[model samples]
Target: MPVDAPRPSAWRLLLIFSRIGLTSFGGGLSGWLLREFVQDRNWLSEEEFLNGLALSQALPGVNVKNMAIWIGFKLAGPAGAIAGFMGIIVPPAFIIVLMAVAFSKLTDYPLTSIALAGAAAAAIGLSASMAITAARRVPRRAFPLLCLAATFLAVGIFHWPLLWVVLGAGALSVAVEYRRLSSGEGI
Candidate 1:
């Protein structure tokens, strides 16, 4: 978006997101994105990248997909957004279908289950690591921390419906932040 910064072509954007999408196994895709779009390419700043990350997470769908859209839109508007969405989804979609078919055929084998379990554990680790990295950027204030914990407890422990929890918690959090801002408290 910068005048001086050379923008990547839409094709290039697709390729970049596609590569990240396909190769980012287990998890840590967001980390890969941050490194590629922010650190390596210098297309976006750290704050901008993190803000997109937060927005993507707060939204209901897959965080990585949301982030792909956000980054694409930021870089090249609507068409870029389409490219980003397709890049992240299309190639992997095919691969996943193929894998599912293959896995179904292999389901009866003990080694298949063991391999999948190991993969699942590694995926969890990657996700947890990403969460911790993202959490470090969250405000260290009591209110924010309480909100985080409440959301986690509701969704993770209580198994509350995510829609209601997100709406209620998001509204409350927004109201609280608004009040703080109105009171001249720095966010």
Candidate 2:
């Protein structure tokens, strides 16, 4: 968001997050959030959203929930963070319980299976789109590209444990960047 942009109220943030939580499906809530806050509303700049996204992904909880709080804090402070957390979590949690009960009885239907398959396909597409977006933001440098390739091969091709790959790759990336910055070649 621009420096001159008006800040949204906590109530508005809560309402938007609640709506997103209630309506979003097929996963990729992070992608939906990027579109909603950055592209559609211009409430946050792309860089801000992406930075929060990276942090959220690195953290231990659900990415979308972490993003909600991050965004809320950026836009509206602590109260907004509370609103965002509640908005993104509480409503959907209740709905999920209800949906689980309903879906349990519908599991025998072929249509149910088909619908689930379709949802899964959509989810994969959304996740792929998000991944591509993030990848595009990576600096087109040898070290970064090599790290990206190594991480991809480790996690995607070799099926190495994700935690270890992330830890190792992240540390290497940080050390390299730190060295580069220390040498005054930082981009």
Candidate 3:
């Protein structure tokens, strides 16, 4: 059976994406964003979400912000994109500014430093969790494995400049993808 196309609704799109922005915490909001719009609501298909993710990563901006713009445009055109961008940025910016003020006032205290150290540790743990989750979802193939190994070598072992590491990884990924395509594998 053919699926019906979704009709755009600006207010609904604003409300939903805003709520997502407000609630996302401890990182990995990308997966949660996918779950909210693609799986739970069926506003986007899995393929669409994946494509948006790829595009967002390629763009020169925060991944989540790029994603919000792309998804918003997909849902309700340019107006939706603006709304989504504002909804995602404003509240967090306001909260962060307030937190920065508080942190500045408390910077000299040893207890504050200790508390920040603990928060940093928790952030690292969260980052590792996100990495493991993403790794589990990656296809287990020789090309991907090679790319991963090369990335580790470039950044972890050799301590190459970040730009070089990114460029090398990106080139390797493209080469692998090209080889896969030539071998008649689906992308």
Candidate 4:
């Protein structure tokens, strides 16, 4: 569902991610990215952004960073990926270092702590919105729905190790899809 977004130069990509990195705090960076790239800019479809979100979650390292690279690569290429990666990572890295120094004193303040808690709560709401948006797009099929529920149970409820859950569930899901495809069921 990728539409023709005016191709942003690498510098422009960096500027965009830099804006996100500079402003976003207390988490929910992916939500900001989703709004920026998908809903606001139409740089990518919700489906593509959701797919990258899945990969970013599955792979090791930072989810937002991975998503930045994924979006950048999809939009431009390797250079664009680098632009996205550095744009998100470098700016935030510096700001976090600076904030850490300042935050030591801030942490002792009750109001500061309260404000941070409120921000965290808001971030969770943002994350929930993103999850719901992605969930709405899942195909209406028994196996896929089952896989979604099982994965949720394993990770969210049972607190299973993500590696095992992903490997086992992914294999099962792939097998099911393969069977459907082979049987001319059109996965």
Displacement of residue 82 (Cα, Å) in model 1 is 0.9
How well does candidate 1 match the true structure in TM-score terms? 0.82
User: Candidate 1 — which residues are off by over 4 angstroms?
Assistant: 1-5, 25-27, 152-161
The parts of candidate 4 lying over 4 Å away from their true place are 1-4, 152-160, 182-184
- Ranking of candidates on TM-score, top first: 2, 4, 1, 3
The clash numbers for all candidates, in the given order, read 0, 1, 0, 0
The list of candidate 2 runs beyond 4 A from truth reads: 156-159
**Compared with the true structure, what per-residue lDDT tens digits does model 4 show for residues 1-187?**
3445588788989999999989886558888999999899887888889989989887889899899999899888998899999999899899999999999968877999888888899899888888788878877888888898999999999999988999999889889889899999864
**Alpha carbon lDDT at 35, candidate 1:** 75
lDDT of 4 at 72: 91
User: For candidate 2, which ten residues in a row score worst on lDDT?
Assistant: 23-32
Output the better candidate (1/2) by lDDT. Answer: 2
What lDDT does the true structure give each of the candidates?
Answer: 0.86, 0.90, 0.76, 0.88
Q: Model 3, range 1-187, lDDT digits (tens) per residue?
A: 0167565577777777677776654455677677778778788877677778778888888988898889889888998898778777777777778889998999888999897677667657655664565565677888778877888898889988978888878887888789889999985
- Kindly report which residue pairs in candidate 2 clash with one another: 1-45
Please, what are the lDDT tens digits per residue for candidate 1 over residues 1-187? 3568898877888999999888765567887788789879999987788889889988978989999999999998887898899999998888899989898888889999798788778767767866776777776899888988999999999999989998999999999999999999994
On lDDT, the candidate that comes out on top is: 2
